[model samples]
Target: MRPPAQNPPTPQTPDPATAAGAPEPRTSPDTPDAHEPPDGEEAQVIVVGAGPAGASTAVHLARAGVDVLLLEKSRFPRDKVCGDGLTPRGVHQLLRMGVDIDGPGWMRSRGMRWVCAGRQVTIDWPDLGRYPDFGLTRSRHDFDDILARHAEASGARLRLGVKATGPVTDRAGRITGVTATGPDGRPVTYRAPLVVAAEGASARTAIAMGLERDPRRALATAARRYYRSPELSKDEYLELWADLRCARTGRDLPGYGWIFPLGDGRVNVGLGALPHRDHGTIDLRATLDQWLARLPRHWGLNEQNADSPLRSAALPMGFNRHPQYSRGLLLVGDSAGMISPWSGEGIAQAMEAAEVAAEAVVLALTRPDGPRRDQALQRYPAEIRRRWGRYYRLGNTAGDLVFSRFGYRPILNGQVMSRPGLLASLARLLTHLMEDPPRDTADHVLNTLVKAVPLRGR
Candidate 1:
């Protein structure tokens, strides 16, 4: 079956109804393939998807004077199911992209509040000297649309309502561009020197390029819904619950629950679960129904208060895909399975990968086509693996133990969470927010554990 497009490897259409002053859908019933790839202008790189990762890549590349084109099947102000919480790492990426976070509709978070085993402790985000001291939260419907405009403002050409069907390749099998349909449903082929698949969880053209998800890696699922919560909507702390037990087995499922306040009279509430051998896949929607009933009545979150229906999506965790860069095509975000097995965080990693890929693309564009360019392209995956391989490998194993029904353990039990001092250190460790060179014992200990796991990819 074909995968759905988060943003097709083309531009997302601007809804005249939704996006004020937005351009009309670049289509002509009289014209074939709408305008064709590149339409009227030429492009050096073509990006699939207008999500965080893809849009970020375009922003960076456009700033470097590279001609980048974004293809998306949907229109602006589209809704994407997400936790809508940004960690310090994600905040850093947004700042790097020059997003105006001080504006309205943005909520600042001081820290994460962990509720486990009837004990709750708030752990402030670490000042690791690499990321910001605070994080921000905005719904993806606004967030994605904002980022798409940011990319366009950076000089990237966007073609709206175009769905990238597959990769266009050379005889030797390197992707040169993408095959897509216009808003009017006519097929068009876009050609460029390099291609990027930032199409969220669905691999899309990357799959056409011979990349398959690695079954050995951890794959997770998440269900989330928005709720109108007058009391907790403005909360500064993102709340998490770790004491969730399965309704059927009463066993600790290997996943955590989250309540991320959006500060707009609503909060994004959800739970994510890892598969277990004994129970296999758990029913997340049903689990969510059970979970909502358990929330404090003071928070004002319940079925009647739900702002949106419960929606579930897959989280391809732990670098589940191989050769993130290959044969002139690069994968970013969910397409590359950049979600952390440790925290189920993907946006920060995806934006970081977009930056890394942009840097590599800029350098490769400096060289003419052929082996030299391909060599530069190789750095994309290599550097990605270098940065994340060890952490993911370790997290994958840890996740297995945490979620496995036979060996399920509450890593954040009362014993560990009750002690604020210890939980503070553990929080830093779990979030991987430590400076290199071993700033302290916590960093050293955490680094040692991460390094002990043999990395999977080269």
Candidate 2:
């Protein structure tokens, strides 16, 4: 669906009559008025972190005329450790945000080329008519900056170099605001009615809220570098190299190395594996070197065009299984452990979740007072779980099967390779069968199945 217009009229403020028993608003040292009454005061939604999830939430909320306070620990144009790959779904989200991603300095992809067991398979993306099927690849340094700018332009107040230290609560234990450290190292507090936590991986907010962490699987280390390679084509097809026998551990780490070609004679290459199989055992830099060395002779990566320093980070794979939403707070992006279990992809999921959360927040603040206010907040978690729970569970299952070298090969060689249709079916199931804004029936079924499945040893 297309994004709504920029900044719709503010929803009716919460009725003062209904909020009579609510605690008086406490102004913070950083705000204009700290001791004003909360009733009739504009409801401000605070979004922590300026990554995809936070930016999208701020943009959507601001567009809905909700006063949004976006806080980021880092400055703009900063680099985030990522594969720099954006799927079609991600591009769609950006488009909805009113950002034009198809310009110079971006690499557009048409589809994917899979190289496994010495066999090659190519899958074409589903057609979107005039719109390209796949996505664009750009460094997060530039990508996140663009999104932050868009959010600011849409009227969201962005506070960079501000880190949320902890939550502010009332006597009732409901969160009322956040305490943060400003760039100058001074402690500052931002008071808001609701907080959206989008902090990546290490979710400080989630922890402060007493939510326990339960990650399903951990990905092996990954390293990436960009090289100046003119021989690489810019058609948007991602290349994956899978060599089962060449792994350091005999368990056959079911991971593949990727070389994504950016249009400007530069290619992004990286490799990932399961945690127990190859963590700290292999020299990822040397492994990338070996892979790069072999690429010139066989694949398209020529030695003459390599440029840029190698980068590396650990990817959080599988479902984090953490409750994504709670009273007075909601989590998105990597903070909520939304990364894909099979592919370790999170940008699309993050953006999608941000939109859903923004909508829920709007509803929660605008509805006529009563138990519905609490119900509105409940909708965000319920909707998110309903939509993504099944796909993530399936991804966890797929990760287990693929990471086990012995198990993955046969599946890759026989089922995935021979049939092609099997992989296609899986892809379709993930994209279509699972719900987005999921129905109650589907949610119940998925919740039951995910809990029923055992996490360890198959």
Candidate 3:
């Protein structure tokens, strides 16, 4: 689906009477096709999905003077179900991309306000040499469009209203490109020397290449809706509530809830939970309804104030996929299951991985089709593991062991919440904000601690 226009109408408080209805369908005006593939139909690289990961990869490659083709099923400014919250880590990626954060529609935030068992604590983002000490919240409708446009401006040929069906392989079974359906609903083939799959959780391209999610990893589901709440609209901190309890047992669930202000007379309300193998089944929609019903009446979380229909999506976390690079395909973002198991944040990790992937692809393209190219391509996974392998290993273990037992309450109720220094350290760890080369005490300790742990093995 396409969005209303290039200039998105800012998300505003919805009228209570009209709030519960379905959203209007928006279509792309330029549906004929923006850029048609050449007679050869070959590019230096092909990136699937126009989300943060793919767009970022295309942007980096295009800026480096590579002929990149970016394909997206949906058009620009389309709706994407998300919390719309950005941490300092994500903010760093935006800045690195040279996005104009100083412009309008940017909802600046100070930090995170966590609530558990009626006790509340607000932790400001730490001031570090590597990252900014602030965060922001923006609707995904406009966020992804901005990134895609940024990539297009950098010289990536973006094909909208196109869906890639499967891989195009040669005799040896190495991916040469992808077979897709064009906007006219006709078959189209686009060739490339290499393919980058950033196709979110489904990982269709990667799956067609014989890659699948590891069954042992933890998965989370989150449901979110918007509400008109003037009081919370301009709150400087992203609010998180960790006290959601199951309906029957009244026991705390193994997840967290959030209330992110949109700064436009509306707020995003949602809850995310990790499913336990032994827990059988959890109805995410029911759970989200139960938790929102418990919110303070003045906050206006009821159906009367609902600005959008409730939406939910699965979260693949803690590197749920293996062998990030196989054959001639490179996996980035949700396709590789790079979402953090700790904070449930994926944008930052996706963009970061895109940078690494772009660098690897650039190096590989410089070399001929030989051992040198393969070595360069192999460095992508190694650098990723060096950066996040150990940390995600610890997080996955915690999800399987700690969160299942007491949720996040034990840590929230402990002295760590009372101690600002420890809380800051925990925040940094959860968001993966620790800098390399040891910038400060927290970074030094966190880096050393992560390195001290053994990397997870296949």
- For all predictions, the C-alpha RMSD in Å is 9.0, 7.7, 11.3
Report lDDT (CA) for all predictions. Answer: 0.79, 0.67, 0.81
Q: Tell me the TM-score of each prediction against the true structure.
A: 0.89, 0.79, 0.89
Model 1 lDDT per residue over 1-458, tens place: 11111222322222212223322212221123534454322368899999999999999999988889988889999899899999898999999889899999999999999988777888888777778999889999999999999999998887779898776655445565677887788877776768889998998776766677877765788889999997788889998887777666666666888999999999999988887665666777777778878777877787788889889899988888767776678899999888988888888888999999999999988875676777788788889888877887777778776654422236777688778877877777566677777777778888887788787542
lDDT of 3 by residue, 120-186 (tens): 7898888888889999899999899999999999999999888887776553345667778887777
Worst 10 residues of 2 by lDDT: 1-10
Model 3, position 269, has a per-residue lDDT of 91
List pairs with backbone clashes in candidate 2. 7-63, 27-34, 109-236, 227-307, 228-305
Global fold similarity of model 3 (TM-score): 0.89
Clashes of 2: 5
The candidate with the higher TM-score, 1 or 2, is 1
**TM-score rank order:** 3, 1, 2
Clashing pairs in 3: none
* lDDT, candidate 3, at 207: 80
Candidate 3: which stretches are off by over 4 Å? Answer: 1-40, 456-458
lDDT of 1: 0.79
Q: Candidate 1, which segments miss by more than 4 Å at Cα? A: 1-41, 404-409, 456-458
